[model samples]
Target: MNDVKPRPAGLRAVPSAVWALGFVSLLMDVSSEIIHALLPIYLVSGLGASMLTVGLIEGIAEATASITKVFSGALSDWMGKRKWLAVLGYGLAACTKPIFPLAGSVGWLVAARFIDRIGKGIRGAPRDALIADVTPPHLRGASFGLRQSLDTVGAFLGPALAVALMWLTVDNFRAVFWVAVIPAFLAVAVLVFAVAEPARAEPTRKARWPLSVAELKRLGPAYWQIVAIGFVFSLARFSEAFLILRAQAVGLTPMLVPLVLVLMNAAYALSAYPAGALSDRFDRLTVLKTGFALLVAADLVLAFTNGIEGVIAGVALWGLHMGFTQGLLAALVADAAPTELRGTAFGMFNLLTGVALLVASVLAGDLWERIGSRGTFLAGAALTVVALAALAATKAAGPGDGGSAEAASTKEP
Candidate 1:
């Protein structure tokens, strides 16, 4: 048998494309966050939208992003291009931001969100694939962590900026939406000018359009197991919108909500890279399992607590969970995929997660409506426990272990 060598670490040498992508993420997040924080208010207060409408809008937006991820990723693979697709996706999202200021009705707002999510769907998979392409295997976790950290930093800053702008404008949601356009434009400009796509190796003559299921099946059982876990994990995790609603229920003032969001993002930013680097050294699944355990604890805490203190603690735990899992999940996807089909792999992984979130959020919304907020949270906690149990059972099984990391590491990518 030929000895398989572990890949060397090359992520310490940050590339120009990574920095550009980070800046793009920072700007884009700033734009998106500013709009996202105030959107519900705009719908409910300004347009008199019902809770159902708000739920539908959000669910649709997320579903759109999820559904398109795989197709877009696969399209990028088919075309052997990543940058232009990323540009298109970012551009689409940037263009849609301005429409929010123009929206006079709930319908218009929904349309704008749909358009923006479509852009997200288009650009997301390719952008991730590009990140995988530039980063070496050994540094993959840290690379993704750094990207996620910067992304979360932008997430932190965006709402803070929105809060400041809202205060300045005396709560003029439209003006805040208008201000978001500037950053959106800047993000697109950075992608177009600063980021360069790496040259790809020549594809075999056998490469075909619309990748085959057999090609996808070539991804071993371990990768599929991770995807299954991701889906379950996502089911337990509902939208952050619910968290904001919970904050409101607990008497947190609207302005204060953004600050709490900043805190959560700060925790995410702090933990993302370190946790990711740890995953590089240790088992990714083990790291992800820790995150799942933390989430269960967070859900239980949130379910029982009644004050801002509890909300803060819960949010912080949520951030910690996000930090540990998000980048590590991406690294696992990258690790499990064949390099040539990485875009496709990431797309499918995201699609499954997206579908999972859609179902989870709907279930959460229904649970909230029927059983109350406490019920919704308790349900999430139960699901998290179930996922953890699944992980434990998988771990106890052993090498031939079906989807063992050793097996995952030996795969194409």
Candidate 2:
């Protein structure tokens, strides 16, 4: 027998639905990153806030999304519909964009950020579930990778655009924010008209009481294991604001700070598709471990080094870690959950991770305040070690699981 194996189908073979979703994500990220790349500086430099305030705001905003995802994911499962909820989420986010440019006080910014994150919460789980639904199992990794890559393209573009616009407007932050609104609405429009819900999995049970104990129990041990892995992983990751702060600390000007995100996201976009495709063919857990190693390496580099070269290398490593793990985690949830419970599973996982992230960011800020920047990253490195240990012995990292192309559509039966 010939030992050579054929490669799987390429991006052209991916569904139109997946591509549409990717664009939706791409547009929304473009809108979100443009603001996010500048939001921390705006809050601190312009609004006279502190790093702790930035961390608190970021944590709370993200935690709110995690809280809402629990309900939104359940709701999507109950309705057996993902697209409409995602549309509503995107629409809600679009409506919040104008507020960023108009806010005069911290309270206004906080309110807008809260609502915007709520929109993210609403769509996050359902959207992930929808991707799993539409694509065959064999293509789930590639599908997710493509979506992440597109989303990351937007991520980089938003910051790169912000850099250009900030210079044009003479560092007019509000103008850049106003421009961000256009892409957000475009995201909503694409989602509304272009994306369609796939057929629901066969009705295995009555739709009532999706959150009931019986239904919750159906989420399975494997899914919970993945959730645990995600939670610990969150502890290792914090707000991107710290990356910008690190860049600024090393003497990068405000107008050029967005370039940090541009660099980070560029690495992310370039790596995500290849990583996702690799996960589809290789052991996802092994790939996840590799991502963990990269994250640890990033933290160590940032912790021990200084200046532009260090920041660039560290941020690029951070992006690489994201490309390696994020989609794999999504695919893990898809593979582990029962088809009917995917939305719920993703929501629950995010909820845990969200809470962990909040705590981690707050801790990071505190560490930065009391000790120094090095302390913050060193702490992150410590947490990454813990997370790596958790994954090595846990149910999440099974032997050669979800490694083959045949495993893409292989949900928990």
- Would you list the C-alpha lDDT of every candidate in the order shown? 0.81, 0.87
lDDT of 1 at 160: 93
Instruction: Tell me the lDDT of candidate 2.
Output: 0.87
User: How many angstroms is residue 293 displaced in model 1 relative to the true structure, after the best TM-score fit?
Assistant: 1.4
Over the stretch 1-413, how does candidate 1's per-residue lDDT look in tens digits? 87997555444565567768988998999999888877866776678975556666787788889889889999987888999999999999999998999988888888999999999999899999898888766677788888899899998898899889988998888898999999999999999999998987665322354358666776657678778888888889887777777777899666666766787788998999898888777777788888998898889888999998998899889889999999988888877766667788788888998888888887777787777788988999999999888876653212113234324434443
Q: Which candidate's TM-score is highest? A: 2
Give the per-residue lDDT digits (tens) of candidate 2, residues 271-378. Answer: 888988888777788888999999999999999887789999999999999999888888888877766767887889889999999998998888899998999999
Candidate 1: which pairs clash? 222-403
Collision pairs in model 2: 137-408, 137-409
- Counting clashing residue pairs in each candidate, in order, gives 1, 2
TM-score of 2: 0.94
Runs of candidate 1 exceeding 4 Å displacement: 1-11, 204-206, 395-413
